[model samples]
Every structure is written in structure tokens, then in C-alpha cells.
Target: MSVDLSGAHWFKSTRSAAGNDCVEIAHLDGGRVGVRDSKNPHGGALVFTPLEWDAFLSVARGGEFDRP
Candidate 1:
């Protein structure tokens, strides 16, 4: 389902460095989540369902994205 990310409070990762080259995310309605680049707040955002977010985070924390 689509969600309106506008006005949604976006935050950068606490692990990010001084330079803001990271992405931001915000929770949305309808069990959805919004994600966008911090450098481009007005840019388009990608929406993901709650389940999708959970699965993505799980994989991320499991070192699925770790370089070999």
C-alpha cells in the first residue's frame, strides 16, 4: 500500500558520520515505512510494508550485506 511520507519525521542513522550522505527513514500509516536520501529530502521516497521492513532489517542485521 502507498503512504504519504510528506510531513513524516525523518531521521538519519546514529551511526552516520559528520557528512550527511546517508539515507533517512520514517514510519508511515497503514503499517508502512518511508525511506529517502538525507541529501534530498524533497526527493521521492520508497515505501515498504511492515513485514517487508522487518524482513529487510533481519537480513541486514544477519550480515547479509557484509562484503565477502
Candidate 2:
């Protein structure tokens, strides 16, 4: 299911790097999630299902994608 994020409330990561090097997320319509870059809000947004977003966050919190 697709959702429009033209008026979503975008929020940046509180732990983001100093130079705005982080992604932003918004609660989109239809119970979906919207993600984009804080550095380029106008670039575009990618929508994800709630389950998908939760799974992604789980791995992310475990440092699965952390760059050492």
C-alpha cells in the first residue's frame, strides 16, 4: 500500500551526527512509515509498512548495520 507524505511530520534522529548526517522519519497515512534524509528533505521519501519498519529498527538497534 502506498501513502502520500507531502504533509507528514518529519523527525530527525536525536543521535544524529553533527553535520545533519542522518535520516528522518514520519508517520505517514495508512499506518505506514515515511523515511528521508534530513539533509535533503525535498529529495524524496520512501514509504514502509509498520512491520517492515519495526523489523528494520530491530536490526538497526542491534548494530547489525553499524560501520566499524
Estimated TM-score for each candidate: 0.89, 0.77
Tens digit of per-residue lDDT, candidate 1, span 4-52: 6667999888999988799988988776888998888898899998999
Using TM-score as the measure, the top candidate is 1
User: Model 2: per-residue lDDT, tens digit, 5-30?
Assistant: 77799987778777877888899766
For model 2, what is the alpha-carbon lDDT of residue 3? 67
Error of 1 at 61 (Å): 0.5
The alpha-carbon deviation from the true structure for residue 24 of candidate 1, after best TM-score superposition, in angstroms, is 0.4
Whole-model alpha-carbon lDDT for candidate 1 = 0.87
After superposition, candidate 2 runs with Cα above 4 Å error: none
